[model samples]
Target chain A: MKYVLSFNLNGLPVDTLVKATDTLLDVLREKLNVVSPKRGCDNGDCGACTVLVNGEPVRACLTIGLTVAGKNVQTVEGLQQDGKLHPLQRAFHEHYAAQCGFCTPGMLIAAKALLDKNPKPTREQIVEGISGNLCRCGTYVEVVEAIQAVAAGKYKE
Target chain B: MAEYVGQPVLRYDGIGHVTARTRYVDDIQLPGMLYIKVLTSPVHKGIIRHLDTSAAERMPGVAGVITAKDVPGKNAYGLIPDQPVFTPEHIRYKGERIAAVAAVDEDTAMEALEKIKLDIEEQEPVFDPFKAMEPGAPLVRPEGNVWEFNSGKTRKIRFGDVEKGFAEADVIVEGTYTTATNDHAPMEPQVSVAYIDETDRLAIYTVSQDLYFHLGMLTAIFNLPMNKIRYIGGTVGGGFGSKNDIHCDHVAGLMALKIRKPVKYRHTRREETAYTTKRGPWTFYFKDGVKKDGRIIARYVKTVHDTGGYAGMGPYVVDKNSILVAGPYAIPNVWVDGICVFTNKPPCSSMRGFGIINGTAADQLQTARVAEAIGKDPWEVHFINAWREGDLGATQFKVEAAGLIEAMKRAAELAGIELPAHLKAMSSRGR
Candidate 1:
């Protein structure tokens, strides 16, 4: 049995058919054609499928599709606005924080969530903010620096 | 050359990564594509008594079920061509592939896998390299548990006479070091999307690190010419030597050819961690003969690599390890014996530094022990024995552009360690 899943995605209302057992990641990638949130680990162990649901970071792989009905879902695809990259995106690129880019989408989303809540995050806070994400390339130092650059207003739009 | 050498240039795919526009193998979706799930061996070592996929083929939403019999050209494929695409009769490892099922979705494919019937006669499995090397051990392969190099059973490196060097030594230090297996665990798991293109050529998007090497292997497995297949790669999400082997491409390509549709095969995290080729465990025994003046006169190293199930890259890794197991030091007499043994775990292959890192770990520890035995500073010992530009390596290769002394000086400065004036004045020109 499939249900019509309607949610606000990247500031636009989108509707798609999904099953009860389908995860938000499945619906986004398979049904809605949103391929930003990767399917690294279907479990909650890896944060590669991270997205913002109702202004909070959550693992889309663990979240059931039906639970996010009528909610605002933001992915890395949503980080761009009016043909301009987000501050986090710009900082990540300028700082060379992404390698292989597998963990970049989830890391960017987690960083966006962190900066939205705390505009002026300390180094420790930045580390804790993106702790859920894992970069197998061992780019955590550069990622933290990128987040710090954004928080320090280096990439203010 | 200097313009871009020291600059902080951004990656070419940086924008795509940040903007979520990068397409990985898993992100690719084609019309009427099916998902793949494989049936693996349950026991570590076993002989397949029975295997039936008819029930799985009859399952609802199951598009196709493929077994060892479905392989058209050849079932064996690897660097050494020892591993089978699908285990036909004998199963050497626990997670060896037996069959695969393609269906409408992952759930359906997984459910269809449960329908397949399989029976195996279990056998006693050996996990330790030492135990496996013992006489009358359960054989992992028909030949034996040890990989035979061109010379003999071990990768041998003999330099100056070790007996005379050890005879002149004032102290002898011995230590044993062991390193556990490691998984690459790339952020993106092993995945492949295979489909027959409109040009009638088999197309596959893989996460392979060595695309051409795998392409050659895939051609042999698929029984097709080189131009008959289109191997698309690059944009890999962190390989770290893990993607050097054909993990999912051959299986997905086989299923696509059998089903005549686009098939996507992706390993779950558990599968990637448990079954994929690993760094292979290493056990090293080091014996160093040192003088009271902190000079390492003689070094003897015997290393055993536990290459599980198959000879993926174990022989090459042992050869590379044996050549440099004596470390960067200018030891006069060095003898290294690197042995590659087989166990009943997942086949171990390549990792970050191949096998040099493992050898270096043991060598560094032995160096520290040599320093302690002679009552000398480790740094002084290192500087005294550092390789010069014209020094002969263990394999008699002339060292060129040696920079160990300069590198150590810079490292000490960065690490906030002050070197004595005499030690600081040492140069690699004459060692």
Candidate 2:
């Protein structure tokens, strides 16, 4: 049965009928045409389909769409504000953290969640923050460096 | 030229990737696009007795059910055309495609696959390459386990007299080594979108390491003109040689043509791990003859590669192994034999080093063993026997600018290891 699922997406209120079985990833990518939350692995293991639900990072693939009915959903597409790239996004680009970029969206979201909580994160903390995301290109060194740069105020929010 | 050559340049697709705007195969959506799911064999080896797709065809959301009979042109396609597009008579390995369904949605396609009835008589599977080569072993293919080159023999390289070199050597070191099969394990699983364009040409958008190679494979399988198929591939998410295969391209193309709409086949993570080819495992035996002074006299390697299930680039892999078995060394006598043997695992294909990496590791390990036996430092022994200019390689190619000695010295310096004055004085040219 489909129910009216109302949620705040990128600070905008959205109302749509979503099936109970539909995942947040399906609702975002398939229904809303929001492609930032990539379906790297439908299972939550890869963390490629990560989005912020009520400011907490969650795997969109695993999160049921109905559960986010009254919550705020933020994706990688929401990162840029008024034609300005997010600090993490700029840091990622400058540090060359994304190679293939399949893992970047989720990596960026997870990094953003970490920074929002702790403004200054150490290298180890950054590693723990994005541990859910996996990059096959072996870009972890650069990813950690990019997150460090963001925390170090290399790119201001 | 030098300014750009040695400098780190930004990737052209970096911004697209960082901003989550990159269009990977799965990200592409066309109007009325259909999703595909395949029905594969569950056993390593089996004879298909019965297959009924009528029930799957009648399923509510399944648009089309495709079997081996639906292949318009050729049933087989590969580097060596041994693998069938869909297994008809016998299942070679578990996860071999038997049929596929085109449906309104991925869930419907998967559900349709479950409805397709299939019966198979299980057969004894040969898992080990060594056992596969043994007499009385079940054949993975009709032609037998070991692959025969155009010359009707396994790859072999012979440069000098093996017996004479060993007879003259002061020390001989021999060892057996084995390396496990490796998966490329790219972040993005195999995915492709195929549709007929306004020009009536089959357009395929997929992950590819080489567009031409993928195009060629598709053309061969579909028996279509080269100009008739348009291949669109620019961005790939970390192939590591795995994405070189036309994984879902041809299959998606076939479904798209039959359905007259865009069809996307995205392999699940489990399907990618279980079904995709891996780097072939190798069992290597190395024998090295060294003089008392640490100058290597001879090296011989007999490597057997486990070319799983089908001959998917196995011949080329074995040939590469034959060429680089001697490693970067100045050996007076060299003999190398690389054999590609079949097993019931997924067909192995290219990876980071192609085939030379495993052979080189075996050769180096044997070199270290030879150094240990003669009470010589491994680094010093390697320096003494390093291939310089004018050295004949395994394939009889004259080494014009070998820098093994210089590289070793530089590596030692970088590693903060203070080598002896004599070892440090080694050069690429004859010292």
Candidate 3:
């Protein structure tokens, strides 16, 4: 049986029918054609499927489709404003982070969630923020530097 | 002169990667696409007593089932023709592919795999390379446990008389070391999508290290013409030598041709870790003869490689291991033997270090032991025995542009190490 899920996605109302067994990641990627969220490990060990729901970061692979019926959902695709790159995205590019890019979307979403709560997070706090996401290319130093760059107002207007 | 040759430029795909726009094999979607799952062997060593696939074909949403018989032309494919696409008679190791089913979706496909009946009679399995080579051991391969090379044994490297060199030596060190098998553990698991394109040619999209190599293997396996298959793959999500092997491309292509629908196979993390190829384990026995003042005169090494199940690049790796058994040092008398033995486990293949890392580890340990015995700094010992520009290596190859002395000196300086006057003036030019 399929259920109709209606929610706000990236500041826009989205209505889609999804299977009961389908995950939020499946619905977003297959039905909605929003492919920013990845399926690094469907078991949720690697947080490549991380997405923002109601301004909080959660693993979309672990989140059920029906649970977010009336919630706010955000993905890496929603990070841009007026076709301009987000501060975190810009900082990631500048710092040479996101090698192989399998974990970039989830890393960006987790970073956005961290900055949303504490805009001026310390280096240690920034490290703690995106600790769930894993980049296998050993780009942890560059990723942390990118988040720290944003926190230090380097990417600000 | 090129301006950007030596520059630390940013990654070419950095922008696409950061923007979440790079495409992977899993991100592909097509019309009338079917998912596939391989039914692997559960027992390590076994004989196929009974096999049934009718139950899987009758399952809901089951499209097709392919076994060894379903292979169009050949059942074997690899660096050597020893590996089978589906083992029909005997199962060499656990997780060997026996059958594969395609269905409307992954859940249905996996359910179909559960419906297939497979009966295997377990046999004694061998896990050790040395134990496998013993007389009366259960042979993993049809010929024998020890893989033979053109020269008789797998590999044999010999030089000046080792007994004479050891007799003249004042100090000798003997040691044995073993290295464990390592998994590549790339972020992206092995996945592939196969379909016949508009031109009626088989097309495969996968994460492959070399497109031409996969093309050649698929051509030989499928008995298809060179123009019949199209391999499209360049970008990889951290292969690190794991994706060099043809993983799901051949099986997925066969299913696609049988059903005439795009077939997708995605290996889960568990399957990737438990079943796929990995770095081969090695056992090294080293005997080094050195002078009283910390100069290694002769070295003899015996290395045994555990080529699991099938000869998946193990022969080639053993050959390279034999060539590099002496490491970077300049030893006058050297004799090395590398043997590739078959064992009942996952097939071992290429990794970051083909086979040199294990030998280097053993060499470094022996160097330090020799230093300790002669009461000298390990760095000083390495500098003294390091290869010079014109020195003849154990393999009779002359070293050119030798930089070990300079590199060691620079590293010492970086680490704030102060070397004695006699050890500090070492050069790569003269012995």
Say which candidate scores most in DockQ: 1
The DockQ of each candidate is: 0.89, 0.76, 0.69
Comparing candidate 1 with candidate 2, which one achieves the higher DockQ? 1
lDDT of 3 by residue, B267-304 (tens): 98999988888899999999988898788888999999
Candidate 3's error at A18, in angstroms? 2.5
Give the best candidate by TM-score.
Answer: 1
What's the distance in Å from true for residue A45, model 2? 2.1
Using DockQ, rank the candidates from best to worst: 1, 2, 3
What is candidate 2's lDDT per residue for B133-193, written digit by digit as tens?
9999999988899999864557888888988999999988899999899988887899999
Where does model 1 sit among the CAPRI classes?
Answer: high
Instruction: Give per-model TM-scores.
Output: 0.99, 0.97, 0.96
Q: List where candidate 1 sits over 4 angstroms from the true fold.
A: none
lDDT of 2 at B334: 88
Question: What ordering of candidates by TM-score runs from best to worst?
Answer: 1, 2, 3
The C-alpha stretches of model 3 lying farther than 4 A from their native spots are B1-6
List the candidate 2 regions with Cα displacement exceeding 4 Å.
B1-7
What would you estimate as the lDDT of candidate 1?
A: 0.93
TM-score result, candidate 3: 0.96
Cα shift from native, residue A46, model 2 (Å): 2.0
Q: What is the lDDT of residue B285 in candidate 3?
A: 92
